[model samples]
Target: MTTLPTLTLRDGLTMPQLGFGVFQVPDDQAQQAVESALEAGYRSIDTAMIYGNEHGVGRALAASGIAREDLFVTTKLWIDDHGRGAARPALEASLERLGLASVDLYLIHWPAPATDVYLQTWQGFEDLRAAGLTRGIGVSNFLPEHLDRVVGLGGAVPAVNQIELHPALQNRETVAANAALGIATEAWSPLAQGAVLGEAPVVEAAAAHGVSAAQVVLRWHLQHGNIVIPKSVTPARIAANLDVLDFTLSEAEMAAIDALDRGQRTGPHPAEFNG
Candidate 1:
């Protein structure tokens, strides 16, 4: 088994750089999928309330028989629950659903700047951390300005910022901003929802390396120091995704993938997505 590298958070905690995500996975399949991922040596699992499968994730965790301290579980607060008063209860509900006393990390799913309540919600995150409900707290889909507001006014720096990134949508600005603030950049749609698998650059690299296009793309992300969560329910893919730790992409190959970025996005823009 490949030992996945871990990234240290600003708060001194470490998280597995390569993890599994349950984004569009249905409730009926999430448990078996996550159990397979765990069996494949994934220590970190990312889930969200909006994904509507936390319960299944919880069931898998409970049944895995893995020690709680050895796993890193992350769940997010949804857009509908974007206020100071609403955040804690939402987290508590998530805890109950996850069957855990506390989570490894808690993230505000989106900035939802349109609502102008992220700062207040961030304060609630701070309160949760202080009260020991979560080991660490962070944000997702937050732009630099949104992060500035939280760090500047709310006074709590996020440990990580989860975003949609891939070879086609590198999101350099956001990644750089996260680096500047010492926040780890986590890539959610690391393969662009399978949009990048057949691209000429990825295919050529995959053939040259004798690996799958998905492995090449995932290796690109790993070499770039971006935390990636590629989700798949297929047992082979679930195991193969973690196989990226073995290979390395050259600088030229890295640059080729970099050139593939055309500002394309598979999901909503942080500045525009209110929900």
Candidate 2:
């Protein structure tokens, strides 16, 4: 098994920098996908209430025989569960499905600013942490404005901020803000849905490093200090994604990939998405 690098959250909790993600994976297939990822040396698992696959994830975790302390499990609170009262039960239900007493990290799936209830949702997260239901709290798809409001609360700060980040959409402003606030930046869809895999920079880096284009992109993310969760159902690809630790990208190569940023986004804009 690979000895993956770990990042410490602001609250002092540590998790593998490169983890497994289960997005768009059917509930029935999540178990096998996650199991394959575990067999490939992944100890962290990221899922969401909206994914509707926590039960399968739980089954795989239980069957893995990997001790709870060795695993980092994260699940999200959906837009529908965006309120003081709604957040706790939402995570409780997720814990139920995941068959765990508590999750390692629980995040608000999106800001859903139009709904105007994330503040309350965040409070609920804090309460859960105090109650020991989750080890840490965070928000996903949150822009600076949303993060500002939560930070302004000055009660409990977020430990991580997961967002749609990749070579095509670097999300520099958000990344900078997260760094300024001492929050870890987590990259979802880190491969740009395979959109930037064939680009010249990625291809050239892959050729130079004797790796695949996907591995080049993932390596770029890791080198940039961003936590990434790449998802793949194919067994070989899952193993390959975790095999990026053996190589390094030169400074020029890193700059070339950085220049590939054109503000392209594969998902809905954070401020515009109400749900």
Model 2 pairs in collision: none
Quote the lDDT for 185 in model 1: 95
Worst 10 residues of 1 by lDDT: 147-156
lDDT of 1 by residue, 13-39 (tens): 999999999999998899999999999
Off by over 4 Å in 2: none
Candidate 2 residue-wise lDDT, 196-236, digit = tens = 99999999999999999999999999999999999999999
TM-score of 2: 0.99
Leading candidate by lDDT: 2
C-alpha root-mean-square deviation, candidate 2: 0.5
lDDT of 2 at 225: 94
